[model samples]
Target: MKTLDFKPKLVSAIRNYNKQTFMADLMAGLIVGIVALPLAIAFGIASGVSPEKGIITAIVAGFAISALGGSKVQIGGPTGAFIVIVAGIINQYGIQGLTIATLMAGVFLIGFGLLRLGTIIKYIPYPIIVGFTSGIAVTIFTTQVKDLLGMQMDAVPSDFIEKWIAYFQNLTHIDPWSAGVGLVSVAIIASAPKFSKRIPGSLIAIIVMTVVVLLLKQYAGVTSIETIGDRFNISSQLPDAVVPELSWETIKGLVAPALTIAILGAIESLLSATVADGVIGDHHNSNTELIGQGVANIVSPIFGGIPATGAIARTMTNINNGGRTPIAGIVHAVVLLLIFLFLMPLAQYIPMACLAGVLVVVSYGMSGWRSFTALMHNPKSDITVLLLTFFLTIIFDLTVAIEVGIVCACLLFMKRMSETTDVKAVYDEIDLNEDADMERGNLEHLSIPKGVEVYEINGPYFFGAGNKFEDLMGGFGDRPKVRIIRMRKVPFIDSTGLHNLENMCLMSQKEGITVVLSGVNEKVEAVLRRNNFHKLLGQENICNHIDLALARANEIVG
Candidate 1:
């Protein structure tokens, strides 16, 4: 493994930086910043945080990621992925708890990078990713329903079923003005790409809805619609950095939640880097990317930010706008900083329902309904994992869903591997021509000696296949003077296999039979020698070929 590599992409990107590249980066960064603005505010409000916190993250974390990241065009900021978990932490343990958890997660991310576990992200099961992602999308949509329709209610319940019940109970209190703004915003967002691809539909929806709602509220006296200012006191300046109130007790309590954040952040950032690599035909150093994310998460929370990661949407926006370097990401941060400092109070005018409409669209895109439906036709085991994760995420939580889903997937994998392992008895005569492992010009046939039995094992001898081997050995008919066990096809042996082999050897000795192991590869022979298997079965009895084993077995039979 390589020692820690602290190199960031920005270091190399600057070597060839020129006026033309800067111009291109400037255009892309400006557009992406515009696209990121509404999303930051919406995610902040939805995550039970002040709206300015989102911009702070987009500015602070966004700058850290681009300045120290591995990917050239990856745009990092607050994303929808953490909404459920962040909200849950706040609800259960308040802002301080969330802070401690975020800090712990940052340290975990750095550890992951230093340990060089970044490549492991590729091993996460696709079904599980889709399952939880779709589940999160549904959860996000549920959370936005109240704001979308302007329902008059207290806090929305955290439980999925109870939250829906609350929505039903409060349906009678829907404000038509808010509902109209939300529906129109959704319509604009859903249809805007058809007319113009360059401009973001979310930005357009926010502008149009904010203007319409403002005009209606001031002149028409339709002042019932709620806006961001009504809920969160907007801040136009960055606050002093804060040290998280962390103790050993708090760290212990927050480990699991922190692990959830680390896992989600790693997956999202690496996935975004992978996608951008495909678009730009460049390979990203995954470990470097993880470290950048670790730094971002660590710094952002100090300035009143929430958990952040690579935003695939904004990264794509950057790519489409011709951003080919980290400079674009840095410029985007600067743009958000300007907005946060000078124009944050104007954010108060943006309607809550309009933000809800934007998130509704995000939830729909995240749903991955097409992938969900396609996966239904896969193997039943995969479908089982998929559905289990999806439901668990909805009914319980994302952390539970991921854990249970991985366990189920592993069990099913072992089951399938065990099924492929073959153990069977060979009778009468063996044909060398039919044996693929033997030389083609060797002995044509070998007759079995009277009262001798031969068995072949055709796969890895792991714990999963140990019981099958035992059953086959114990179920054989007739007493045998000699037994030859073929292990040419077995690639490796586990402790369970060694234990079973020992038991078989001891049982054979008591039955007045000589046991021989045939085609024992160098590795298995070393394992047997280490276990003193040769003392139980003589060293000469372990043969390299079936012919040699048959000769020894015939000598025993005679």
Candidate 2:
């Protein structure tokens, strides 16, 4: 069994802590915290929770992820990706359901880490990931249209098509003042990057738009514009812990969504860690990263927050701003906590349309349109999976898209594996120099007996290829007296492959045909010994070369 990787990067980073590193971390943390503020608020509101809850998540979950994560500069908080699922859960099962689901997801993440399945997760089909992420961006963009345009509607339907139709119906009811504020907010955020890299665009958009909205509402008598204060009762202090009532029924109902959260969290956190690793020239412990994320998710929701994961954008910001340790992340959490305790009430002045505008940019970033378009030029099968996952996420739900996408990817993988492994019969040739075994090189050619046949397997003998090989074996009619099976190129044999080989041995025995194994690799031979195939086929008949196998076959033939 593998040892648990529970060590956090903070522990390792602190061993070499210095004043210079501390100052650098402080600066980066301060900047990242400022960057996280508007995003947290926007992600919070978009996720169907209050703005304060988003801040609370940034403080609490952000701290946990940084303090306990394996990566040096990973920043954890509420992100735009969770908006769809969190909102959907709230819409269906209520707040308690979201809470329980987050808790369950945390448990699942911990289990995944403890099981040491991190490397496996990193290999999940890339196309499926792109598809899901792109679809999420589209869904997020769709959700923001109402807020972005200031549509006068009671409630936006959750279904994708229904929501768009309602938007069309409400097009004539657009609040011009709100629309003006939203459009201006979007323009500012979209263009602010050219002004200064030191400041975040979303923050500038909020400050500028908040002042404009306030001035218009106060002096110009424009009462149509909406702000955070008008929507949610913004809180200044950390809220009391919320204990959700859990029942078996609730657990059963939330399992699917909870699993989705676990998968998303694992994929995102590890991807962020991997990206940070490339830039930092350091490797992150994936298991430790996952456990840290699990801890964050489990704790944040108790404080009335939603699911939390490592934010890639903020992480890159930390790197770009000279953050080289977990200290920066911890400091960022402290910064957010201070804001939560003191400056949270000011968030009420932040316009909801500005947040919608912030998210509008966010959605566009996550769209991965360049990658999506590039993938369109890939293999037809990849394109099929991409489009399927994309449409399913928009039309139905993320849960459905992920599950179906994974299944299809697996099936396609197996199909490709089976196509690559081939079993060929070489009955006429006997070239000793052409032998695969290097140990038996530079020898004379050996002739095959009249009643002997030699077959070579070219790839992995997994279940997919095993069944086809078994069928080919069954197709044989003029059975030879001596049959040589070459597996020098065979890397490993799964259970099905072993079973098929065992059955072939039994059938050959009953048909009075002597079977000789030649060039079986050490690993496959070890597997055969463990399964007692050596005992059934007789050990002498298994040879390291055709020279010995043919000699044994000649004895059997005599």
RMSD, every candidate, angstroms: 1.9, 1.8
Per-candidate TM equals: 0.95, 0.96
Best by TM-score: 2
Best by lDDT: 1
* Candidate 2, superposed: residue stretches over 4 Å from native: 438-444, 470-477
In candidate 1, residue 534 scores what lDDT?
92
Clashing pairs in 1: none
Candidate 1, 448-533: lDDT as tens digits: 88888898889987765656656776555788899899888888887888998888888889999899998889898899899999
